[model samples]
Target: MLELRPNCECCGRDLPPASVEAMICTFECTFCADCVAGPLGGVRPNCGGEFVRRPVRPAAALARHPASTVRVFNPAGCGQAEAAR
Candidate 1:
């Protein structure tokens, strides 16, 4: 199961489970619409991949698959910077 992170690592913006604003890459690197559409300009994140919208976990299954308050991710460029050297 994806850790389904709650914020954009760059901006530290909240991305709630049901949020329509959630964007993710194949690795499920989460970002907000604002980040991609505005400053980031649809650039692939630290994972070196494009992003897509995160799926909403159904409310009926809420208890069965509870929402996470914990954010699971590292910022972009950390690995890329190291790889460059």
Candidate 2:
């Protein structure tokens, strides 16, 4: 099951369960679309993998399978990603 992470790993932006802006790598490293297109350049910083849009869990299903509350933020990593780009 996808963790459906709650925020952008790079920017720390809030990404609720249904946000269209959420993008994730195969390892489920979450980031916002802006971060992916900008600093990340569509590549995951932690894993050298491309990103894809994160699926929005159905509203009803979210109740049973809650989105993760834990956030993964790495401002320094985002800076490194920009430099690598």
Candidate 3:
């Protein structure tokens, strides 16, 4: 199942379960469309794959499937190198 990440990986924008702005790579690396298309504070995740939209979690089912708190963004300064390029 999709992690339904709570925020945009690149911008830290809050992405509630119903957000359509959340996009994910095959590896489940999440980012906003702006970050996917534009320079995200200088990081383009090196996921080595393309991104797809994250499926929304049914609100009522959340209790059965708790959300993951694992946040996956580029490692701090390293992202800038991607943006600089």
Runs of candidate 2 with Cα error greater than 4 angstroms are none
RMSD of each: 4.3, 1.1, 3.4
Instruction: For model 3, name the residue pairs that clash.
Output: none
Q: Model 1, which residues run further than 4 Å from truth? A: 72-85
Question: Higher-lDDT candidate among 2 and 3?
Answer: 2
Locate the minimum summed-lDDT window of 10 residues in model 1: 76-85
Relative to the true structure, candidate 3 reaches a TM of 0.71
Instruction: Candidate 2: give the clashing pairs.
Output: none
Q: TM-scores for all candidates?
A: 0.72, 0.92, 0.71
Candidate 3: tens digits of C-alpha lDDT, residues 1-85: 7777777766777777777888777777677777766664323346446667778787788778866777765536236536655
C-alpha lDDT of all candidate models, in order = 0.69, 0.89, 0.67
Candidate 1 positional error at 41, Å: 1.6
Candidate 1 vs candidate 3: the lDDT winner is 1
> In model 3, where is the ten-residue run with the lowest total lDDT?
40-49
Task: Please give the distance, in angstroms, between residue 31's alpha carbon in candidate 1 and its true position after superposition.
Answer: 0.8
Q: Which residue pairs overlap in candidate 1's backbone?
A: 24-52
What TM value does model 1 have? 0.72
What is the per-residue lDDT of model 1 for residues 1-85, given as tens digits with 9 covering 90 to 100? 7666888755678988888898887877777888767555565635556767888888777658776677754556323433443
